[model samples]
Target chain A: MHSISPADFAAILLSLKVGVTATILSLPFGFAAAYLLTFKEFRGRVVLDGVVNLPLVLPPVVVGYLLLLLLGQNGWLGALLNAVGVRIVFTWRAAVLASAVVGFPLLVRSIRIGMEGIDDKLIQASRTLGAHWYDTLVTIILPLSFKGIVAGSSLMFARSLGEFGATIIVAGNIPGVTRTIPLAIYDYAGAPGEEAMALFLCLVSVVISLAVLVLHESLAMRLARRREP
Target chain B: MKLAVEVVKSFGVFRLAAAFSSAGDRLGIFGESGSGKSTLVNLLAGTMPPDEGAIFLDDECLFSREKGINVPPEKRRIAIVFQHPHLFPHLSVRGNLLYGYKRCAPENRRIDLESVAGILKLEGLLERGVNNLSGGEKQRVAIGRAILSNPRLLLMDEPLSALDDELKFQIIPYLKGVCEEFGIPFIFISHSMTEMRLMAERVIVFEKGRIVQQATADQLARLRMPTSQVGYINLLKLGPPRQVDGLYAYSWGGGELLLSFPVRRPDSLIELSSKDIILFKRHPEAISSRNLLRCRVVATFEAGNRTGVEMDCGGERLIAEVARQAAVELEICAGGELFAAIKASAFRELG
Candidate 1:
């Protein structure tokens, strides 16, 4: 209650950076996976779907362990990555990677629901009007499913802000670096006589999450108004 | 333009196999619902490839399973007007009209934006959104959009089937506007015989996904094979309508037809049901009926519970359905001249 602590400022800023980076970097894959799941037909589609959703049901620690063996030094992929002089373990890049992995399923599930809700007749109509499949996807499917995209993006952004279990295992709690709000709260809660700092960090998380949701709601409403037919 | 199509496709228990070749622009395909008319339209538009067949349009192979030549809908130089005016809701009328226009190459393009807008009478509604336009107006904009794409041919899948009767007829003339302006061949698929007669120079009748008959208008009328909907139809040219005794008089074929509507269009299509005309062997005088045509019977046959007579009146063939007892009592037979008495009502407008 005395003043703004340097540690709290660093944690908040780091949290925002990781959440935004995770959202922007994972968006393309999320869209591709959701659109593919909604439209395409091939063998093992259900199996591929299950694989994308595994992160949602499986424990976060298990996910972090898999990432560790795959990306850590002396591991198969890690050794290859080290050869390229790119060390991601115990760094901010690893923090973003962990957040993206944890939040991707939510993003894809919401976008897929959006794509499924579109009227299929419109897609067929577009094709008949001299538009290729790719053109139809961009002009008809994406514009109509924009609401779902907004909902998914905001949900993923909020989820990434609160990521903790997997992020701690992979990125570690390096102060002024990979330590985000959740990690900072965990640190304060673990110390003696630091309950105030923990509660302040919790309040900050709630405010940021609420702001994102409110902003998303307003933008979604504007887009929907423009689409009234 | 010439079209040759022989295709076979199956969906679950339903199968569609149609084959026909014609060298006309204003062609009509008529069939009942679920008779694969829509599927045939899709095959023509190149949106759905035929399972096993070939389609040739003016020497250009649109689809060939053997030759591996399947031009997609985008590159086929074809346009479609569906039953519902499936306009893009997010796009304004201008955007909807310009979508294909911008995508088409300049060499393939012939009709410009302003010409189509003027022809379809959509010049004023260019900026309006689809939701703001009426059903008729939306259909007009749809026609404009299809024409502006500079298609070599247009595929109309019951485009006017969604509108009401008066509205449907009102838009029929608009179709003529396009036909006269662009001279682009049209393959119209519809279930209504009235619509087929109005738009088609050559008619192909479909039943259960098979080509039952393909002939001209006169040849089709002669083949009155008693199919429930379009048994025997006589088209009359409507003259200027005048009200008399609270009924409207429309003159055609050296006579007049009385109706209830205040129809004003001259040369409009009026369909008279053959089953409603009463036969008079003695030419009864002072009868309540208005139309009493002296005709020579060309043929007579058993049609259900009645006698079907194909009569010729001044180079025009007419079909009249008379009861079996009346026909036997009047001694109705082939090559016998008789008077056909018809009441003042029983007239329907097709377009």
Candidate 2:
């Protein structure tokens, strides 16, 4: 029988918390960006869309470096926060921010595709039915794009769980405080005679990724059925 | 409830320019596809902004380029039902219906959920998911949802065009009842003359993006068909006449007209064409005709003097065609009574 260490178990729980927080923080902004990109036409729209997707093409380390410059204690935004006595650097919240930055592109892209696939006439009909923009979004757009939201959140959570480069650079690996599962696995793998613990963490990551994938596929299938005329 | 609109907009290569108005009435916008009917509805509903012009619903100006006023769709107080019902897939029938009502201001609320459901015959569907509804059922739910919003105006852009004839017929009465009960002004778009006759009291003909004609229902119907086709046929007031049997009899001009041909279904209204009619000046002495009526022409018209005359015999009217020379010789004119004859086979059943 394999025994799991308390520190390793704490890392798992912390990883879940980070993944969930990142997903929740990014979802509303992701939906808004996706909807604007898919439905509205304005000057510089293409530029805005490209910017939202920058995190996907740029290296995770680069994203973390950018975050550090903007959010570190002596950084521009960090200076303003320090004046107000609020700190975000080298904390669990910083890990969530890094995860969200890396996962945003994926979340927005999926939701945009889902928004584009919806029938425009349906939105028009809702407008004619006396619903305003916010009402229409809540009642029509959100409900219809629910599958995309679920899929995007799942993908983001899975990606955040495995986040290593950005999290390491921004939050700095600290056991029991900031060290998530992926970071702990990296730390264990670096030490001599800790190969078994590293392997166990890797196996756990694979299982989580697989489960999320299965759940996403099932949700997507159900949404497809509902869309059928 | 007057609705006046003038809008000009361009989308890529498609340019739309339209202007028209209607009082408190059921006005139909009739045109072929790509004639900008849907675009007109969109403009009216405030979904698309017009490059120029204004729309006034009664005294409230919904949109105006001159005044630089553009009300958003939610504040327009208008309801629209598209050809596709567009019910929210995640919502049940009840949820879909209640969505608009919840969004409306309390002071502006006029329709209740129960009343809308009852009017649209949607009581049995409240608990069902919108995704599970049939084509007709979805339309009913869509209508109910729109009504519950307490809209001042209702726009229907070919709402029944997607359904089959049977379904269209099934749901049309409910729609008509909704309009009548609420006294809400309706701008209904349709291509079918039959549907126009069934619902609209006024008609606005569209050619391209321009309004060609706007007339009352009876005037539109008269202008649509030739003068020869405008007349009353012998209407049989049936009281549970034979079930499934097509044969029936009705009296007109003190004569019996036997309907020997099986009507297939007699529960619905039927229309007949004027071209199928054959007229005679005298009662046929010898013929296999199953239907014949003796009557006098109350009115007549000269169809280039070639077609003899259109005769109104008692309450039934029939058209007879004769040579131009024969019309001068017979001396047929208005108020001249004449014998009109028809063969039973000429009456084709239109359901």
Candidate 3:
């Protein structure tokens, strides 16, 4: 194993930061999307479902390109942000955005499955009991889908840690600002006589992924135990 | 609750067109599966929208396609005890019971959680999670939850269909007692004639998505006797039993009934199938049946291949089914005397 450098350590910390930020920001939106897709009937439902899942099937590089087009300087969203004296492109925020967009589908899909498994009669009972739809969602649907939320969050966080193609395109790989562990590993693998450093970063990625999976499994087991007799 | 409903709903080839006015507190919607009983419940509870129709409860318009007045389910204040318990799995027994009570409007709330829990006998199980509850206990919690909502009308959609015979009988009392104690009118939905008779005073019979008949629950039972596999069930309420010879003797309708099954309750209900009674024009010297009641023929009605002999035994009314040929042999007529023989083992104890 090679000794860790300042840049490598920054990469590890930035990866954790981006993963946490992205997961936290996407939680509410992902929950809403899942609820809408699973429970409600509305026009353009199928289209919304397709749009939410497009990122999952599309290549990360392609998604990165689309995010670049949507948030780049001359883009409508970018122009609106510029009016407010804010810049998203080529910053750590852009990297978080890139990771969020790439991992959103997985989160929504998991939560949607959880919501769909709920018995229809239970929802009907809640409504007839004088609970409005939102009240039922908060009390019944949210608590029932806790396992799915935990699982999805872990998946999205893990995905964000490995996010590289989209971050490099939209956030432009800046060593202390936007470079994550995967990006740092890519830089080391491309240099001469830096195989050991790349291997060390690869070991770090494995350890983080394993830790996330173990945490997810423990959470899911606890939930299962609590739900059973 | 006086409910007037004129609703139409369709799903592909099946269309439900039902209209009726029920003023009774205990109204039974009796129908077999796919006969639109559940659909009507959904429409009345505001869970499903009617294509075009109107619904009024106690002269208050709940839905009117012409007037564009459609109240959502939460605002309608009609709660249902579904076939399955359907208790919120994520909640404890207490939480599930209070889920609706907390949301109920203050002025509308009449029943409190403590009272409901007492009525349903759910106090001990309140803090426990719903997952471990027995089927009967879970159903009690479901009933408690619905009752605590303080709705004007309770819709029981085949609530007992999911339980075994013992559990079904156990839950029926809580269902009836809670509604009666709280003064909440209910519409009981079921295909079981016995259940309908026990729960509802008046019944609306549905067949193939239409209202075929509206009559008292007993009338409906007698009307369908020939077609029903179990025939007409004669529900009898008897006083506490005394041991006589090897059987339990119960003082019944102006007479005594010897039952092979012993019951310990002060007052017990027993059911005897109409086919179980054998009528004889003359008292036979050699008869194996234990009880012989001399009854006068009140009226005779023809039901398919059998003649239903409506007899007045002392002051109680008992209907006995006999073959049409046997009826002619006995020369059965109104206001005529006849001997009805029944075995001690024929009486089945009920909850």
Measured by DockQ, the strongest candidate is: 3
Model 1 regions lying over 4 Å from their true place:
A1-3, B217-225, B229-231, B264-269, B290-318, B323-338, B349-351
Quantify all predictions' global Cα lDDT against the true fold: 0.84, 0.78, 0.91
Q: By the TM-score metric, which is better: model 1 or model 2?
A: 1
> Regarding DockQ, does 1 or 2 come out ahead?
1
DockQ of the candidate models in sequence: 0.56, 0.49, 0.81
Ranking of all predicted structures according to lDDT, beginning with the best and ending with the worst: 3, 1, 2
**Residue pair clashes in candidate 3:** none
Candidate 3 matches the true fold with a TM-score of 0.96
Candidate 1: residue A104 lDDT (0-100): 95
Best by lDDT: 3
- Candidate 2 residue-wise lDDT, A1-229, digit = tens: 2368788888988898999999999999999999889888899998988889999999999999999999988799999998998777789998999999999999998887778778997787677666767877887888778878998899899989989899999999988888999999898888888889999999988887898889889988887776653
True contacts kept of each: 0.54, 0.66, 0.91
- lDDT: which is higher, 2 or 3? 3
Locate the minimum summed-lDDT window of 10 residues in model 2 chain B.
B235-244
Question: How good is model 1 by TM-score?
Answer: 0.90
After superposition, candidate 2 runs with Cα above 4 Å error? A1-6, A190-192, A211-229, B104-111, B221-246, B250-267, B285-289, B293-332, B337-351
**DockQ, candidate no. 2:** 0.49
Off by over 4 Å in 3: B264-268
For B66-160, candidate 2 gives per-residue lDDT tens digits of 99999999888888888989887777788889877887889988779888788888898898888888888999998888888888888888989
